[model samples]
Target: GSSGSSGQALASDSEEADEVPEWLREGEFVTVGAHKTGVVRYVGPADFQEGTWVGVELDLPSGKNDGSIGGKQYFRCNPGYGLLVRPSRVRRATSGPSSG
Candidate 1:
């Protein structure tokens, strides 16, 4: 007698996504640069740039675009509210109740 089992592996389209921190995800509130806060809209590679990029919808209208660049839309947001920056420049905001 013998027993057999099969395991499945989920493959992600973008390997770059794994390179970014697991805590950084879409809809998660994050801080960009030094004094700006926004929600994570997209976390992956951009066709226009190399490495991983984080698309955020800033609360202020100081971003460069509305989540699109070079005719490609990474995410949707109000005009001038979308920005794509390296994952290194983004971090989870500590404004939540968990902050001490």
Candidate 2:
């Protein structure tokens, strides 16, 4: 891995990072994939990945990480219950109970 100097155009990149869905905000209820429900915890660029990412605390133990990547913590959640996904893959969960 190449460890370039820090402070390399954060503002400029942030402008593009603004692509995070306007309706997507921390604390919002969202769903990723099918049958996975979680709450939005973090919404912004991640140090380990490019573009805007959504940190979610899943209601079940079915996730990829604990809101961290490459040893960097973005948000906190139980093991296997935290995941970071692209905003495009997230959907605003319905206000009613999920159908079986």
For TM-score, the strongest prediction is 1
Q: Candidate 2: deviation at residue 43, Å?
A: 0.4
How do all models score by TM-score? 0.76, 0.75
Q: Rate the local accuracy (lDDT) of all candidates.
A: 0.89, 0.87
lDDT of the structure predicted as candidate 2: 0.87
Cα deviation at 72, candidate 2, in Å, is 0.8
**Model 1 agreement with the true structure over 1-100: per-residue lDDT tens digits:** 8776665564567644436888999999999999889999998888986777999999999899999999999999999999999887898898648734
Q: Stretches of candidate 1 above 4 Å error?
A: 1-18, 97-100
Q: Which predicted model would earn the best lDDT? A: 1
lDDT by residue (tens digit), candidate 2, 1-100:
9988777665664434346677899999999988899999998888876778899999999998888889989999998999998887899999887588
Which whole-number lDDT from 0 to 100 does residue 89 have in model 2?
Answer: 80
When summed lDDT is taken over every stretch of 10 residues in candidate 1, the lowest stretch is 9-18
